[model samples]
Target: MPHDVVIIGGGHNGLTAAAYLARAGLDVLLLERDDHLGGAAVSADAFEGVDARLSRYSYLVSLLPKRIIDDLGLDVRLVRRRYSSYTPDPVDPERGLLIDREAGAGPDSMGSLVAAFARVGAEGDADAWNDFYADTARLAETLFPTLTEPLPTRAEARALVGDDAVWASFIDEPLGRTIDARFTSDLVRGVVATDGLIGTFTDLDDPALDANRCFLYHVIGGGTGDWDVPIGGMGAVSGELTRAAREAGAELITGAEVLAVDPDGRVRYRLGEGEGEHEVTAGTLLSNVAPAVLDRLLAVGTADADARAASSAIAPRDQPPFSPDGPLDVPPVVRERLRQLAAPEGAQVKVNLLLTRLPRLRDASVAPEAAFAGTFHINELESQLSSAYATAARGGIPSPLPCEIYCHTLSDPSILSPELAASGAHTLTVFGLHVPHRLLERFSNDELRSQLQAAVLASLNSVLAEPIEQVIATDAAGRPCIETKTTLDLEEALRMPGGNIFHGPLSWPWAEDDASLASPAERWGVATRHPRILRCGSGAVRGGAVSGIGGHNAAMAVLEASVVA
Candidate 1:
């Protein structure tokens, strides 16, 4: 019998969709090209003979909704860090800005900001910080709840924000303008701006306001936008999602490569290293892959006249009837738009280091545990970030790379083995910004990766009291137990076009204009030109981060579409 839904790609979003649909009594089948289930959210022993399970590729959890966790009964635990961020001054290494949630001057929560700002000798800065965040928090509270619902029209969403000034500052204008206007300190402005640049490569002055859209998603996740650490690395989250899907009767198949997908619900896939191809029929197909990937898959059987003519020759005997009523043929204008869509260029380099012990900081007053526990900013001053961005935009890596570091062991040591835990070993994850794919395009993969690794270590050492290289643990072969994945590496490994972690530049979560769409599915923004198929990944509207909003919305789209379901 044909499956009710065939979800391509076994990422967390796909798993979420599968669990929801299967629980609703739909037969769901999930296929992953990789041997592992999680697309980029998997934890693995990156270094040989290392006892640490690093959350390779994408890290941290902020955008995941609590409702999805509760509804799916996922057994993942997210632990919040008291210290939000600690940034060391490049000129005065002894003094740094530490935003501690626990330390405050008053009973009010704004005390944290007051205390942090006071430490930096920036009088009245706390009020500015509070005011700035209060606005974002308001929007987060109002906008986050609407993500699970149908996509609202632009005007409706604006009305929901209810503040013309807030909308103008955040949605209409560049986020940098808002930051510059609100914060007096360059360090503070840079720290806030970093949120807007996560996995996105755009300048603060970008006229398109792409940075603003990214900033909104970063700050508005889960209403509070707190990026908590998963208790047992990212694998724990994916594992629970896998369990949920399986328990709900969704059949997940790994090591299966989906070669083609038809708008009419036909899927062709091949098993591991096998030559014989298999076909499956689904009442509805949900694609958890990126839009570019889905487009390529659809184009496979319809790219040419010969292929289109032979399409019926390869049709399965028991194939379900194909529907021609929906937008089956890609419109010429839409095709041109797809072609013109800017390829997402990832601007971050990820470094996973197995440390013998946490590196000591230059600031003697700040304990190493406290600084390493939260995000440690390095060379991330506003001027530095702008300089680095400008340099990288012109195909040059900045000398002092802007990056942030976090030690997983400080928050959750469950990922480490008993011996490693007792030995005081920790894993440090560093994310360097402004090292876009274009900067590394000049060198071979190996050569550029080596150069990037050297640059990252140098950048880290610039802020530390001692050279970080001396503290790195050596693997069995005596090689440093450190690994780096560049944007190009992610592009090749994860099939992320241009190595973009968000799949593409995030789209505004609402319709631009009030136009009558054929169906509610189109209005929902999860629906594609093909009616039977829907996007359930980071490429979908309001899609990014670890949030399953896209998956939930995609499932809701199918469930609401009586014609498909």
Candidate 2:
């Protein structure tokens, strides 16, 4: 029942792999345990029967390679670029959000962006972002040749990366420290600093914060920060890949779980309902699941490579999606100022209040765009946030963590159906941080509503002075399951080796290194000994963002395996 290639997990990236392989004329089959595919990128009932985005996890598509879009003819319905940013009070008049509503920064405008960076963090963050982009992007842009080039021997890669020492130094330094020494403004710092810690455990205050800066270099800004969802949701990316894979001639199986991947590359799965076992042997196998998942699968084959990665981070039970990451808590009321602060991601779970109308933040002081664009919200200051983080780290809800309220409807009007818009309603993405999943974990699904509602209402009243209890429709709810989960918050969640964003922590040095441990060609995972069979994500390469470079380069290695053979 098998052919060219079989893909595990129907996550967008996995689908992307299937698409490319199938398009290349390889028979492909993708398997997902869920009846509905699209993994984390999905939407469900907001609460009762209303539809809302389940962006509880993995929300933006900032780095999906464009070649995939063009090559596969993706039916992507982009929500369009409507720039919106939050600023301290007294900045904009309409909605307390600064938006380039008119796309105001024309080329000649030299638009106040760099200067604004200076405003946010003195002269450093502005200059840093500028310089960071210029140098890294240059390398990133030109990487296709080598990354996709046939696999070179370990010796070959070393010669290439070994030439760059200064870049190497940049990699050696702790990411957080790099940012601290460079930026003066907390705004700019938070903006750039958040990247380092975004998807991993590198805390902002972790003086060893350079990891964030290293990660900042990895923000493959979707060729300019346009990471977005297609008309449907992130599902579009997976949809297109699935379609392409089928067209290229791959059979995809959903609701089928493969129990093992042997050292010889045999895939074993449940054949039918109440069925025993079915085995499909393929030329090679790939895993998109966490390394821990792979380890157990490959354990059947006793593959050392699989064993190493799995033991490193994935095997542990109880891994949360957002680990070390919890709901954010801060209160402007605490300090009466705009400062960077986050208390806890657990203990005080954040409840998003999707609205039917544009929130009237028109205080004649704040920017209107901030009211509805990209993870928008209301909040408190730094001290409150810090206090919230500390308190939550100890497992207790702060009576009044600040608030984050966002109306996504105004930014992407299409999120609502004709019926919803006609009713003066829009999509809202509210995030509550520092929420302890255990609090809700203890309650029955039915009884949890009041408890969750009361907690948010109390926090909002104390910190935001807004009545959220009335704003949230009791019937509508997004992914309640994902809402209460955090991958790093608890001790048992799957931990990527070293708590790094990539399968493991990656930095410029790794990227700039050659295929060999010694020189240029040796950088990356190019060393001949570095089996392409076990490559990580595309962004796994030293470059940035979650680009498929690692996969691309690894694919080339697989292709090279053919050539070398």
Candidate 3:
């Protein structure tokens, strides 16, 4: 007899759905093309017996409904540590302004944020900062539950957004404009607005700017704030989920390869050693591959017309640079200079720093007692970050590379060997989105990548008293891989029509009417016009970081499906 559900591509979402269906007693079988599950969430052997999050994409959870964790008893594996925070004040010499909760950091998290904004010299900054975040916090609260909330009717959405102040924020404002108009200080304005740009490739000044902000709002960590890593490493969550999936009677296979699944409902696989093709079939098929891949799968027999249409119809869109063309663009002046985007794949980069110790603030005295507030950008301000974006548009990597550093060790050390965590060593993850891929055009060979990597490291040294390069352990050959998957022209590679991660420009035309058992939304029950498939995981999602939202959301969606059934 066919299994009740056959899930393909064992990424978190796929596994998550399988786990739910199985727990629901639905005889679910999840198959990953690769041997292991947690596709992007899996760990790798970078050193002898040392495993770390392979791509370590987004290493924190926010906007993930706590209820799901409780319902699935995930709190046992995913613990929310109190040490997640960051600073945006470059000139203050004192970081930790954004949200510091340690002893004497401030009256509270918001208070610390207000104080941090004040240092940047924004007039009316404190109250303004408080009001801003209070509004942001509320939005996170309302939309978070609404995410798992059943499909909303047009009326339901209007009513929810109407009463929920946070939901109301996204309606009319572009993220960048809102920041500049309200805050007097560029540092504060840039700092607050900076988040609106993270993970997105949109030009901040773009017309559809507010969408990223809404995406940002959906990602908040509920007092824990957005963006964090597990205590030891992201592998903890992956390891835990793999364990749970197995305990629940789900089989996980690694190294087994599946080349294709024909529409005839025959699943073909490159089975075990010295084996032949293996096949499996089920009454229902669930796929965890990117919506693109999933489209190909469901399109097999045209199981459902809308799913097939969506799969074939999906277009990959690029995350446009945050800046659009025109005056009042970058900087206060240069109205007529006429800026351009990085020529056809600019030289953007990502530099991962494995630290022997926490990165010290140039003035270390400010955060004397704090372990990790996530990170702070230094040597320059937000303009510097934006400047890289601007420079890359011309097809050249900004000489002094722009960067942001986050201390993962201190943020959440539970997953790591206590020995490593206590040893006071950490890894820093930084990416250069502004660098254009076209700049690679400058070199005939790999020399362009080398030059870019060296430049980023050097710029980083200039900012830090102790540069990360000093302690980088060389391999057996005494040669180092300067950057590890270290450089990617993301705008080119992942950007597709259905909306690329850059700027999340594809999230337009919000679909409220989700399908329910009572009434399905058109042909799609829980799917969307946008690729309902999530690419959000370490490296796979926005460059890299190992947070489990992709998995979490998939699981929640599965639960929602249960609700519908």
lDDT string for model 3 (350-426, tens) is: 55544456555545545522524444554335566567667766766676665555555555555345665576655
- Model 1, 461-529: lDDT tens digits are 887889998899998888999999988889888888777889888998887775554575676678787
What is the lDDT of every predicted structure here? 0.84, 0.47, 0.48
Residue 471 of model 2 has an lDDT of 43
lDDT of 2 by residue, 1-565 (tens): 4455566666555665676677677666677766765554444444556655544333456555666567667676566545534533222223232434343356732345544433433444455655654544543443323544444443343344343542432344565455556655544444444344343333445545445444544443443444455565455555666676677776778767778765555677875578687777665455555454555465544443356458897453322232122222645354322210221122323344555444444353434444456544333333344455566556555445434444445545565567766777655544444444333334544454454455555644442224444444444344231133332322122122211234433443234323233422233353322132343342234323334444444344444455556
Q: Point out the worst 10-residue segment of candidate 1 by lDDT.
A: 317-326
Work out the TM-score per prediction. 0.92, 0.69, 0.73
The top-ranked prediction according to TM-score is 1
lDDT of 2 at 176: 45
* TM-score ranking from best candidate downward: 1, 3, 2
Instruction: Name the better of 1 and 2 by TM-score.
Output: 1
Better of 1 and 3 by lDDT: 1
As a TM-score, model 1 comes out at 0.92
